[model samples]
Target chain A: MKTIWFHLMPYPELPDDFTDEHRSVWVDIDPALFDARVGHRMYNEYIDELEFAASVGFDGVGINEHHSNAYGLMPSPNLIAAALARTCPDAALVVLGDSVALYNPPIRVAEEFAMLDCISGGRLVAGFPVGTPMDTLYAYGNNPATLRERYHEGIELILKAWTADDVFSFNGKYSKLRYVNCWPRPAQKPHPPIWIPGGGSVDTWEWCARVGYSYLYLSYFGYKAALKTMQGFWKCVEDAGRPANPFQAGFAQFFGVADSEAEAIELYREPAEYFFNRCLHVYPGFADPPGYKTLNTVRNGAEGMVERAAREANERAAQAAKKAERKAAQQSFSAASHMSFEQMVEKGYVIVGNPDQVAEKTVEMAKQLRIGHVMSLCHFGNMSRDLAMHNTELMATKVLPQIRHLWDDEWEDEWWPQPLPASDRVMPSPRPTVSR
Target chain B: MIDLAQWKAGSLEIWREGEGRTVGYLHGMVCAPGRQPFVTELASRGFEVVAPSLPGYSRTAPSDDIRNIHDWVFALSEIIDVAGLAGAPMVASSTGAMLALELAAVRPEAFSSLVLVAPLGLWRDDLPVADPFSTTLSGQRALLTKDPTTTALFFEDHESGDALVDATIQRYTARTATASLVWPLPEFGLSQRIHRVSCPVTLVWGSDDQIIDPSYADSFAACLRDVRGRHVVNGAGHLAEWDDPSAVASIAASALN
Candidate 1:
């Protein structure tokens, strides 16, 4: 099995009374709360952790996009991925990805991604996400009615721009380029392996299946809750008559492995609580706009639609229920946040315990879902840099080596990043290693 | 009566009433209010009103041919042409008025005159219009009308079975089509082309209209080359006709005459 370390890079110093004092942590979040000086240090610390994970023998290190939110500070994942490409040579510099729809011409994405692949010596995993409506529709000013249409159009334009051999005049519904030429074609022939990060939309599932791309579901809502979606994707693959190669799917989970269960709980409990309770306190209204969800998705009661359907139920009870949930952090933290250490472990929201326990639970999770890639989120919320470093080393030394051989003999990973041929590879200066 | 008009790949619902000189009626962000008391009053005033579904709205499945604002103008112009209102005086409300303003600007030969009510086309930085796309039901209801009771003219609840799905799809698709025009912001540069509208234009707004403020009435009038004057109906909101049927219908009657 291929395991990667994904970082969300959350801002952890929010006031204790954040739930009461703040309306939300996204889109309309108070800019006054963010300090540039603190951000400078936090960013460096985050990049260091990602590089550290790559150097310590993890197969890959990942980063993703979020916008106008404190939950994930990296709005532009490309900027961070470029820095990672320069610093970390060996690991898959998984840009778990850019919201391809946000770019105007979207060829800009093709251009930038091509440059990143070249810089990384062909070690880029292009992640195309439709993006949350909060980022795409409201924050980015995309019309929700035509959001998907524009997104599909953007993807079409990008794929064509990347692989087209000749410069041609292209006319798209959203973008029109008189001379279509993508300078500096990708290092990987055709393009980098496309990974789609979705929130369980059936359209996204069938799309990824049909296109032979990996559907990486990154959820703060742990593996137990995520089972519904994982099953849905597996079903799509089965229905499509495609092989259920574990490499075709990836799932992200929070973890803290230690020498003992007590030590693991003590180390991870705070950050786990912080991520679920504070980082995820987005305003319900900002998450969905009119026509943001497709009618099919809405009818099917997909992951994103439940919140919208509840808010728009036209019943006073439903409105009050939504309002109550939004206002009270305690209500959600207990039910889904699983803040208590035992609850977190029981729910499989966070795999925190001794190395044996962590590895056992993680392997079981992968085998049950038939997920080939397990994306571990080791650094989350506001764990101190020193502790984050310790967590990375422990997970690398004690946990990863134990489970790296699970599915290797049976299934080939076609979705993993292909290393450049030795002649073209530009290896970064190897970081001095701590004894493995 | 409301009936489906199948043409090409799109199926449009056309509502026609009364008998006389045809009035090319344009609906706003909401579905056709059917033969509501306001539409009924307008019909009783002796005029055949033709309100066809805008492209990709109501029962009219969206077409690939219609993409942007210009595409919308072209498709709507085709509908107007097919309805045989080649040079009819038009009555349009809310976003419908926004489209009518564009059409009249593009092809002034097709429209004889225009009565735009609570039209939302002009952008105001200081007096930014309330966005209906993101708001909840109650919040949207508040912005659109002063009295929630007036919303009965738009939302016919207590629907059962087939009628229930029909009502839900009606509201869902209406907003979907509306967001294509007014979302993010209602500023599609109609101000730059409002001067090109050759026909005499009358702007009517509700005094208490919360959606598109009444102050925008003058802002829209300021950009037009020709103006037949502006009127504000008391005790009305953005859907001024629904709130004050008599006042809006009377003003529209005078403008059309």
Candidate 2:
């Protein structure tokens, strides 16, 4: 099984002088302060870390996109992936994908992906996601009604642009292009492998299965929640009668390793809460914009989550009906909910333990699910660079090799790089000699 | 000849009228009978103006199901298709301004021009305007009317009694109002897509509008590459048409040319 590290690299300090109590009050954070201080450091550190992951023997490094939030600073994962392409020689730079519908001329995605593929020597796994409703409908202001249509159209145009040797014209309901030609055509003939990261949309699962694209179930909620989504994906694949290409399916999970399970749990607890409580504090209205309102997000089950949060808030409000009582309860809730490591493990939000235990549990999960790719997020919300590096080294040296041996060692060359013609290849120029 | 009549779009009854030189009307939340006067004023200027009752307002049936701005656009498009005025200009006011902009983005060829009057979708974090519908009739009157005396005169012309005024205020403050405010606007990336619009656009603003600042007009004008012109009526609040009918009519007439 190929091991990929997904890093969010959350900021340590929040600009609001407000305590954790204040931060927990509302989800909508001001981006002005977030961008001013830690943004540049976070970007540089994340790049360096991912590049280091390549050197340390991780097969791939994952970068994802999110907008207007401090939780995930990478609004443009492609930009990070391009930088990774230059820095990491051997590791696959996975742009866990672009939100295709957001781009006006999604051909820009095609061109950029192609350029990245060439630059990385065909080590690009292009991920196209139908984006979250908050990002696509609220942030970007796309009509929810036309989102699926627009996404499919954008994907078709991108694919055609990548593969077609000659220029072509497309006139779709949303996008119309006079000429379709993407320069720096991907080094991988017929374009790089396409991965569709779905947020449990039925239409998306069926579409990915039909189109022969890899389906990645990003584990946002607990493992049990992710299990149902992954089961649905596998069922779709089975129903379609598509051969299980090992590379055609993957899963991402948060992981933290320490000297012991107790310590590991303690280390990951706050970060997991930060990801869920802080990062996922999207405005309720923004979750399912009217036109793009789906049964999954709008139905009773989906509405329950918001209702639960609101109910909790209401209860807190009622307890605080008197200013003094409210203040006392707020203080108690703040102190009590500091998020211990054991709770995070129980929540299934993270895999935290010694290297041996983590490795064993990871292998058990993969074997049980029969998944080929295990994407681990070792560096998450507000984790220090040194700590992340320690975790990465442990994962590379102790955990990965053990799990790797579990898979068939016959050297499956299906995902291996194909040989390029001498005329098509460009050798690196010699470095300039410097006086030391 | 332009046919003027009320028709049904799905579950909602739309007060759609006009044919040859078509203009779609988006009435404000608390619009009353006098709202038709703006339609008449536009009609007199040699243009067909169809002011459809927003889902819960006026003769239009109230819809608990309508969730977002695009749903309103779908209803608007159905009216345009039914009336065979698919290739007509739209003059949307307040909330309707957002709907009109969405329609233009979704189907750019449907209209020749879009006239948005004090549109409400753009919200800046720094603005001091509290919720427009939170106040009492008198409080709302103070906020919406640029001049208190002029506002009293306008209300005297429209509001028959305390009962009618209260009912109007209640209708405007229902769950529908909350839905309109909460429903996410289309992220057509219109700021970028505006340049792709094949038709002309005209933004009409009340110079003293408190709901949305006139400063926003510059951004709108800058983004809309095909804007024919922008006219700001003086001494008007958010509802420019009601404040100065002649000025709004003249702006509509200018766009027709």
Candidate 3:
């Protein structure tokens, strides 16, 4: 199994009264609350943790994009990726990634991804997430109905820009570029590995399976809640007649490790509570715009599909009961809001234990979920640098080494970034193109 | 009570009522008629009201493919034909008024006269329109109707099981469809083209419209070539018809006459 150290990089100094006084922690967060001096220090410390993760032999160091968000300081993951490329030499810089649909001429995505791949000596696991409704529709002003359409077309345009042998003229629904050519093509031939971090969309699952890309279920809800989704993704892959390699599936889990179970709870409880309660305190209005979930998803996915099936079979009596149950299950992730340490442990929102126990539990969960790649957020919420570093070292040295050998002899892990050999790598230089 | 009419483009339901001279009533963001006295008052004044529930508002399928104002204009124009009001006077409210202004600007001959109530299209950097989507349910209700009693009288939540789910879906789908028109910001550059409307236009606004300020009515009235000036209804909010239906009817009747 390949282990990744993921950083959310939350601002830790929100006052105790922030929850009561503030309506949301995201888009409408008060700019006055941010301290620029603190921001500079946080950036350095966050990068240090990511670089440290790479140094300790973790397979990947990941950063993601979120705009106007206090929880995620990375509005632009490529900036962090570029910086990490210079320092963290071998580990995959998972730029998981720029919201492609947010760009006007999506050639911008191709250009930036190419730049990162070139600079990182081809160590880029390209992640294309159809960004959260908060980031895409509300914050950036992309139309909710057209966001996924733009995302679909943007990825198409980007792929053509990167791999096309000659310069091409492309006219798409959302983007029109007269000259679709990317200078400084990715060092990875064709492109680097593509991983889609889905919010459990059926369209996303099928697309990831149909094309040979890995699917990362970026769920805050633990394995018990995410089991159906992971099973659905594997089912889609099987239905597509593709091999069900565990490497093609990636899952994120919050894990805390200490010398003992009690210590682990004590060490990570504050940050866990802070994350579930404060970081995720988004306005319900911003969560789902009316047309944000597509008709296909509404009509074909789990709820819609099941409702239709039950109705067809004259099982209307059973449908309503199912719906009420489903609604409760969806809200289970909110256990983080004022969660007790025992609640976090029992529910598996965060796997907490001693080093050997955490390793044992992680391997068990990974085997059950059948995911070969685990993006472990060992440093979460407002976890301090010292605690985060200790957690990172423990996860890297204790947990990773024990389980990294899982499925290593059975399957070729093709979905991860292939860092080019130092002798073979050639970095591209910037040049001004003369316009005719 | 109005009868629900079905159309073929999708299994969409439209509301058609009253008789005499045809009046194309483009409803506000919602199509709730619970105790709303304007349609009856219009009928008493002898004007036939063809108030469409619109696609997505009445258990009808909205064209999921509509991504912008251009598509909306076409879909609404098709509805005008479906309602058989190719060239009738149009009374549009809120979001519908924005659609009407755009349609009238594009076609010029679509409406004989336009009665636009609290139309939501123009954007002012200095005087920003408050976002309705960002608010909670009670907060939005407070913005739409001036009297809290009026909201309770109409949208009484005494539903359970399937009825509750049905009502919830209907309300949400309508709002979702409206988001396509007004999502992040309500302005779709109708200010640039409102000048092109050829029909005589009357702007109606609630004096205390918290959702959209009544002051914007004058701003919009100024842009049209043949505007009949702004009419500010007293003691009303955004949905002025619900607050003071007879007053709205009086102004619309007097203007139409």
Candidate 4:
């Protein structure tokens, strides 16, 4: 059995200067508040933290992509991955992906991945994603009908471009390429490890199993939702009669660690609210594009989404009706309608506690879901830079080491890179010793 | 000859050589001959129109499951591919506008130009309206019509009784509107990717549109890098084509020419 690999990706916080009373309104926030100089500084600081994670023995550092949204400012994870490739010596630079469907000629992805692999000396974990329906169809204007086809087509092109030795001409339903020759082939033999991130899509699980790619389940809901999806994935694997490779399966969750469970929960309450209440306010229209509808979306169903929006709409209407009914009635309703923190905790959308409690719960989840890798969002919501760093450091120093003993013999160490050759290695500058 | 009435009644109807052109029209949510005039008028203007009822909309049988945007795109793309009109310009209004824009963006080689009228997918946070589908007919009516006077305009020519039409509108609105709200916004970030669209795009807005704001026109123009032109028609709201058909048709003609 392999030791569990823990990865942390921090969402850089927006400047404190920006404020919106109608923050719940459209997903727009003033971009002017973002100091470009500070952004550059923060970028360097974020990379330094990820590097520190590697120095402290984290298996990997993660990065993801989002567009025109204030929540996650990284619209291009590849740029971040490139920077990390130089800073982090041991950790795998996981670009949880460049959405294949969004790219015009996905060959650019192949070329970029190859370049990253070369620069990192073979420490790149390439992620190809189908992307969320809202992002693919509404955001990118990709035809919903051709989304799956184009995505699969892009992947085929990317894989061929990565592994092929000869120039290739390819024509497909969505993309056509002539003489697809990519330079700087990946440092890894068949190509860098491929991971496909999905939100409970059946086709994605089946395809990942068939191709021997790692299936990373990104569970924004909670552990319970993720457990069901991972179980479904394993069943798919069993149905296919493929060996259950623990290394090939992973899951991610939002986590925060502190001195005590009470302190952690208290510290995380506001940021968690920012993530769920504030960041989750996507207009319903952008979620479902034409063509991108998969069976899973149908299964997870629109009724829930519809009901939530309808309920919210109805509640507003009812509130307005109440006001019209009587001002006193409106006051009574407003006074009565307050959601407590305990109610939110019961919902299981966020988990905050000390390292011991977080580790215990995480291990319990891993055991239940059979997940080998856990991508922890230690830095989330509007968590301050200092708080995020503290959480990351705490997870590294305490939580991970505690869990390490549990799965130490599970996986072989052969997967990790060997010591660099003398000619390829560079020694760090020595520091003078000081006696205090 | 394609019988406009039959076509509107949910049959597969194709007409070639009428006004020296061929066109297709997929009726909105419910299959009704009354909507055929919208397609026929476009044909009269020397343009081929193609509109197929979606699986759960109009006279077409509802699919076993309500599919995502991909299903509609695939159906439309197949229709365009088979018709050999891959190079023809398309005009899509209201809900259809989203599909038209997506088709043009995804497979630009198949289209010469795209015209979107009061298109969906431009939800602003500041808007006070509720999703048309999530609410009741009366609730939606209140949000959509600025005043009670304008509310009567929707029923003026509708032969369907006010009650029946209102029910149909609610169901259609709820289904599509609910579908939109279920997915994440970044998934619809085509505003940034509109630059990748190779074909010309012309966005038309109804000046008094109560459902979607005219200000969205600026956002659309900013996002769609290849826009040919944008026009805002006065005295028109969400259904500018029906509210002021002549103006809408003229703008479509200009874009086509």
Where in model 1 is the C-alpha error above 4 Å? A305-346, A429-436, B31-33, B152-170
Candidate 3 chain B TM? Answer: 0.93
RMSD of each: 4.4, 10.4, 7.4, 9.9
Flag regions of model 2 displaced more than 4 Å.
A15-28, A35-37, A244-246, A266-285, A293-333, A336-338, A405-430, B1-257
Residue B68 in model 2: lDDT: 52
TM-score of each: 0.91, 0.66, 0.87, 0.65
Q: Estimate the TM-score for candidate 4.
A: 0.65
lDDT per residue for candidate 4 within A38-62, as digits (tens), equals 6677667666666776777777888
Q: What value does the lDDT take at residue B105 in candidate 4?
A: 69
Ranking by lDDT: 1, 3, 2, 4
- The digit string of per-residue lDDT tens for model 2 on B84-120 reads 5577777777766766666677788877777778766
| B1-257: candidate 3 lDDT, tens digit per residue | 44544565576455565678888778786546322578777767888877776667665677755878888888888878777777999888998899999999898999999898899999887788877766556667787878755655335556777676666566667777777778778888888888889999899999999878888976887788998857989899998887888888888877788
- Classified by CAPRI criteria, candidate 1 counts as medium
Q: Clashing pairs in model 1? A: A246-A372
State in Å the error of residue B60, model 1.
2.0
Best by DockQ: 1
Predicted structure 3: lDDT:
0.80
Model 4 / residue A198 / CA error / Å: 1.7
Worst 10 residues of 1 chain A by lDDT: A308-317
lDDT of 4 by residue, B146-254 (tens): 3333344332344556656544443443344334422333135456446667878888888877666778777777777688989998877665665566677788877
Q: A313, model 3: CA deviation in Å?
A: 38
How far residue B34's Cα lies from its native spot in candidate 4, in Å, is 9.6
